[model samples]
Target: MKKQSTTAALPGKKTVTAIYIFVLAYTVVQLFWWGILLHQQSKEIAYYEQLELTHRVHLLREPSEFMREMQRHHHEQRMRTLKYIGEGTIFLIIILAGASIVYRAVWKQMRLQQQQQNFMMAVTHELKSPIAIAKLNLETLRKHKLDEEKEKKLLDATIRETNRLDQLCNNILLASQFEHQNSQPFFEPLDLSQALGNALQELRDRIQSHDILADIEPGIGMEADKFMITLMLNNLVENAVKYAPKGTKIEVSLKTEQNDLLMRVCDEGNGIPQEERSKIFMKFYRIGNENTRKSKGSGLGLYLTRKIVEQHGGTIAVRDNLPKGTCFEIKWQDYSLQPV
Candidate 1:
């Protein structure tokens, strides 16, 4: 069903209204200026008439003459004022027309964004149930071994595919959450170091298989919502593992910088193209030209990380690391590191 909404005025409408009011008020100001000029001319004529030009008989004829001249000037000014008012109205109309175009465009963009978010959420929910069941079934199948080596290989492949599905589902969930303005993140303060440590422990198998190195600086602490922070690092670590060259090191650094807690994840992977850096934070945005996203991830990690940071009044960004790599820097304003 096509939803019909009696949508209230958005910021765009209010801005257009403001422009119209400003233009109309400017037209009134043009009339007002003419009136002021006419009055000033009358006053100047009165000063000159009784003193310098005429009426030694105390100004009867001179005042009438001055009034007539003032009337004539006022008539001329009225014509100019009317012309200005007409021009002002036309300009205002053009501005209003332009504003309406921009407003409609913006409104359409917002609606499309909302629709996409809904679609991602619905799809994620639809897939999650089956993916979980498949994972469970695969695990169950591992119990009965036909041939030891063959069973192990099949189990590993199944697990890999399951991880891929989970990653996709996670991306969808992140997109859905980001789309909601009133999303209340589940927040609980935790040690920043311990959280990273836990995440690394969980990815142990991937690390061992890929021989990925964790260049972690020891003993950093901070105040943060545990689950969100964990998710943040999980995305970064996963991104690093996915993109970094084989046998390359992923550096995870946690420290306090200028009264803000910072987590800098540097991967010796292909750096984001300079043009695409701004857009990589957008949902569903994938790096093009690289075409090397072989590992499974929903492509929403950085975007979710950004939303979570904003929720906690923090910031996250990506930049080129010196000597050919990408670095993700997360800064938390109200965070602190724990004692060594």
Candidate 2:
């Protein structure tokens, strides 16, 4: 189904702030009226005093004082009704303000998710041409004669880039589904080491050309959607390779960090700038640092990567790597779905 545009679904932050301000002003006006009119809710001693004074002035009967007191009670009741009306009005204003804020925030998020889906579709299209080119190159090589080792190397390159493109396409699709709450994971007890290794193998040429170095640990395992694991690893590794400078080593280390399955990919590039760090996972977030931007990206890779991770009950974060560069770490819980 076609999705609604995000621009129409979300109220801008300025609008939310304006509504808040108006609510506050209305509350102030209500309180001001309260102060001017019936400030005290307590029974007024002055009412009784005025009644007694009039009684003494006219030597009035006891029944007249009682009647005057009754009139004072009626007056206070009417004033209270006005105050209650003001209070109710103020309460309605407060409630509407809260409801509008909630509606705007949630509506904006849903629209953003739809836009992300659109971007994913675009990314899938971008990936196709490169993959077809790689495939054609590989197939054409089989038709020609070449030294076995060199041909093997070229074949490897084609395969690696093709796999990278494939992984990226799959990530976009999976992320789109997950973001829309449509991904139903086929979970089973699986090996993390193998899944991560598969992604690394596909990226070997990219890693070698970029001089990225990896450290792999065996026996790290998690129960997750196998496809999602590969997609997640692909994003982390690709992102590291893309940002790190030429000849700098990129490390992929996996082990159980406490109760979570921890996989870390670190790059020895110029590193992410501090200011733009918080927005790195946003759908269109890109670094302001000129060095990283030099490398091309769809800007949705990490965003999609994180979505897949979240689907499997995992967390991903980026941090500065020691003195320089950046490191991304993912932690996944080990939980199994019981067979039905």
Candidate 3:
């Protein structure tokens, strides 16, 4: 089915074009008016000069005061014309600059709206797929009598789908909280190693195709919310699983550096381009178009991850892994050890 374009509904292109045309036409008209004013002032000066020359010739004995007064009047007239032109030029430049700013703001808003529309569609599809799959499995279980191993496999699949749904819902809620700047998580000492283990365990069934090489530092702790940290790690791991090819290894580690905790996730996948590194953390800003996207996501994972990291006085950064793939590094600042 052909997907409907969200940007098609926005209605500002024609209006913006008209505004630009009007500004251009107004600028041309102002320039033309200035040219005519200058021509008229020159003509007047020439006419007066010719008259003074004739008067000087006809009345050679006339006083020099008349010529002095004529010169003074011409000087004042020239100054007035110059002042008007200067003020008009400044006004036109200001108007053009203001229009450009407004146009850029409107363009950015339109892009954001389109991205949000895409997000809604992606979320709806993502939610529906897991529910539909789980429902089908349930119906099959109720209708058919399956053997022991087969039944277990079906049950595990159903559980995996359910877990996916739960994760999706949590992402939506966390994204909403971050969007509204209401992410005041209860901070305390959290075991970083345990959090990584739990997060990896949650995705063990889902990541059967890839190998996870974890080298976590033992007894490493930091000031953070455990649940939030788990969610953040889950998101990063899930993202790596989705993007990285099957059979490639994913690396996870945690260590301390100068009173800060450093968490790292490395995946052997097609690395993110340098230009798109900064934008991946914006809400609803996906790398590709939603209509033809191959990956299953609502584009909220990295954004929520960044928000969670920031809430804990931390920073997250992306880098190219040596040889191939992408690396995600997170640093938590002002870390405190758990009490003995």
Candidate 4:
């Protein structure tokens, strides 16, 4: 029903925009047409006045007076014509400017609405897939007496699906909180190296298909919220995992250079297009069409990651990873490490 309503509204929006453009075009055409008519009318009036003056001068027998009157009339007519053109041009410029602004605003709103609709579709799939998998695994276990190893495998798969579902819920909730400014980071002394290491270890254990590599420098500390940092790390690594092909390398690195702290996650997979780099962090913005894309995500991971990074007074950006794939780089400049 929601999709149907959205589909129906799109045509209406397009129709409204079409009508608006048509009206604006008509108005502009009419404005120029009227200016032309007025110019011709002014010329006709001047011509008649000139003839009348010539007849009067002939009767009075004063050629000098006739020439002076003709000059004055011509000057006044020129000034009136210029004034009309100037006023019409100004009005046309104002109308065009207004139309451009309105068009841009409408386009932006439509794009946002489309993104939101894609997000809804993605979220529905994301929510249902894990629940279905977990349910199937449970049902399999309930129906048959499975061997120990088989049972363990089934249990692990179920656990992973549940974890995925839990993380999805967390992302949705955190995104909402951050958007509304209801959640703020609670900064305290934290073991940055240990936190990163632990997060990477968890990822390695849960995701067996990918090779997760950590090049973290030891004994680095900072003032940040531990929960938020862990969440951010999970989102970044998970994003790489989602996009990168199976068995590809995912490199997570953390180090300090002078007073600046840096973290990077580089993946060996198909890289993001340069055009999409700027928009990847926008909420509900994914790379491809939601219906056709094979990847599974709600488009909130990077958005939440950026928000968490900014909340901790840091910056994040994406760049091409050397030969192939993409790299997400984060930096905290002039960061002072707290004593562990």
**Highest lDDT: which candidate?**
4
lDDT tens string, model 4, 1-340?
A: 6557667877988898899889999999999998999899989988898888777876766778777888899998999899889999999999999999988998888888888888888899998998999999999999999999999999999998898888889999999998889997789989999999998898887999899999998888988899899989999998998899999999999988899999999999899998999999999999887756888888999999999999888999998998999999999999766556
Model 3 lDDT per residue over 23-51, tens place: 77787687668767876886687678767
Over 4 Å off, model 4? 1-20, 58-64, 145-152
Distance from true position, residue 123, model 2, in Å?
3.1
Model 1, position 191, has a per-residue lDDT of 58
Off by over 4 Å in 1: 1-81, 84-145, 207-211, 217-219, 241-247, 257-259, 289-297, 333-335
Alpha carbon deviation, residue 122, candidate 3 (Å) = 1.6
Question: For candidate 2, what is the lDDT?
Answer: 0.69
Model 2 — TM-score against the truth?
Answer: 0.61
- Top model number, TM-score: 4
What TM-score, computed on C-alpha atoms, does each candidate reach?
0.59, 0.61, 0.87, 0.89
Q: How do the residues 49-132 of candidate 2 rate in per-residue lDDT, one tens digit apiece? A: 556556665565677776786677678667776666677678667766776787788667765665555555456545776778
lDDT of 1 by residue, 1-340 (tens): 1122213324655786688678667766765676567656755655664354334434546677776766665676566656656766776677667767876796667655654544454455446755776677576676665677766766676675576566556666666767876566765555567678777776665454334445455676545577677777777877788778877777777776667777788988778888888987776555531123344344577788788778778788888888989999977776555664
Ranking by TM-score: 4, 3, 2, 1
Error of 1 at 308 (Å): 1.6
Which segments of candidate 2 are over 4 A away from where they belong? 1-67, 70-78, 81-85, 88-103, 106-164, 188-191, 207-209, 219-225, 256-261, 270-295, 307-314, 332-340
RMSD (Å) of each candidate, 1 decimal: 9.7, 7.6, 3.2, 2.9
